[model samples]
Target: MKRICILVIVLYVSMTLCGCFGPGISDYRYDLATGYQLICSSAHEIKVVPKSSVGIPMIPAKVVEIVFDDTFILAKQLGLKKESENSTYMIPDEKVIRYWIINAKENKIYGPFENDEFNKKQKELKISDSLKLKDVDSYKKSK
Candidate 1:
């Protein structure tokens, strides 16, 4: 009995040390109904409907990844290792008629919407509180 108890304690310690469980977990990448490929806190449950929302800028509604940090000064200093001279080309900011991701951060989305975080064409919508939002995953799978 003594040997068995010691062995169990050792095993438990080993398992704990090996991260059998703890708060050192981070899920920074997961897909969402909006198709944004969210890299947000999975601990927070995303709602089928957002109470309020914001807009995306630059790129088209469905397009991902817009805007390049083409610092002209950096290019001039480093002589641009292999970047194209026109690669950093930027257009003047216009009306918020589109939505796009801001580089690899992914969640920094921007788009035109009257009230929700997602767009109808980009995601399924359900009528609620005078607005619409992406359908929940469970709800979407059934259809």
Candidate 2:
């Protein structure tokens, strides 16, 4: 019984130290400044939360990817609309990839838009076309 208890304790301690049961930030990347961070907390959740330097920005849905990062941040979020229970429109849920942008320079944020709307907003904001969205995994691998 003593040996069995010691073995169980050792296993639990090893797992905990290895982060198997940790619910902490798994991926964190910088955007524009030191205080600005794009974070993915917990491997199981698999979502990104942009932490702004200026103030707290609220994001409604789970962000899947951080597409662009500079003075401005563009992210792909999961789920924006849901089909009404009684309505005719059958909008798919979670299948749609919504876009969100955060202007760290100006402390302004815009979000949860379709592709066209996002483009239009980009143009309106006079953001440079040179800055492009990137594949998060590929970008990480190259570094």
lDDT of each: 0.30, 0.59
TM-score of 1: 0.27
Q: List model 1 lDDT by residue over 1-143, tens digit each.
A: 99999999999999879764533354333333332333222323221111124442122212212212211000000011213556653232333333322322232433333223433423442213222222122222210
- Candidate 2, after superposition: displacement of residue 35 in Å? 3.2
Residue by residue across 28-125, what tens digits does model 2's lDDT show?
44343223454444332334443533345644445556655457777666663435767754332567778877776665679779989989998998
Q: Give me the runs in candidate 1 sitting further than 4 Å from their true place.
A: 17-28, 31-36, 40-42, 45-132, 135-143
Residue 80, model 1: lDDT of 15
TM-score of each predicted structure versus truth: 0.27, 0.61
Q: Pick the candidate with the highest TM-score.
A: 2
